[model samples]
Target: MAHVDPSAPLEGKASKETERKLKRESRTQIVSFVFMVFITTTAFLTVASDVIPSGFAIPFILLLASVQVIMQLYYFMHMNAKGTGWVNALIWGGLFVAAMTVAALMLLIGITKY
Candidate 1:
């Protein structure tokens, strides 16, 4: 039988592989956050610049914000792999319905009866 070395770190101690994995995960979160920010910032800038017609700005901004919210829910909230499937479906469904209602109202209010 071989003797165990007391000077060596225990198996539970952080190994290089574990550290690398953590660093990689951290980078992923950073990247996701940065991309979300970039998308929203650009969307706001476009709306403010009046480069696109006012009719297009609201839809564009809402679409971009929805995408960012989804990304944040999946990446930052750790909901990508966890169960909670019903909660996810329910919330997103509600949001979709609300968005559709708003869009329909906007169309009705802006359109001419003639």
Candidate 2:
């Protein structure tokens, strides 16, 4: 058996875990980027294609944009990471307020035919 130095930092074990975590995060980011790219291409194609009606394509693209935004916030912004509860709350609260404001405006101004 080999003698171990107690003074040495246990870099092997810690580094391995850190390496695995970084690999996982990198893979996730790549996948998210690819997905976002796909969504953008699809959105562009939808707009470019004459077969797709503007009404449906517009909403579909908006939905995809929202998905991209959510992924960006979670992955790139690291909102889902450690000790970001306040940030998450603030962001979500702002979204809620904005949504409510839009809804109220739509209702009051009769923006929609409904």
Model 1: lDDT of residue 110? 83
Model 2: what TM-score?
A: 0.73
lDDT tens string, model 1, 1-114? 299888987667688998998899899999998998899898989788957987888898888988988898888876776697987898789988998999998899889653
What's the residue-level lDDT of 15 in candidate 1?
Answer: 88
Would you estimate the TM-scores of all the predictions? 0.61, 0.73
What overall lDDT goes with each candidate model?
0.86, 0.92
How many backbone collisions does model 2 have? 0
Distance from true position, residue 54, model 2, in Å?
Answer: 1.7
In candidate 2, what are the lDDT values of residues 1-114, reduced to their tens digit?
399889987664557888899999999999999999999999899999999999899999999889999999999899989999999999999999999999899898895665
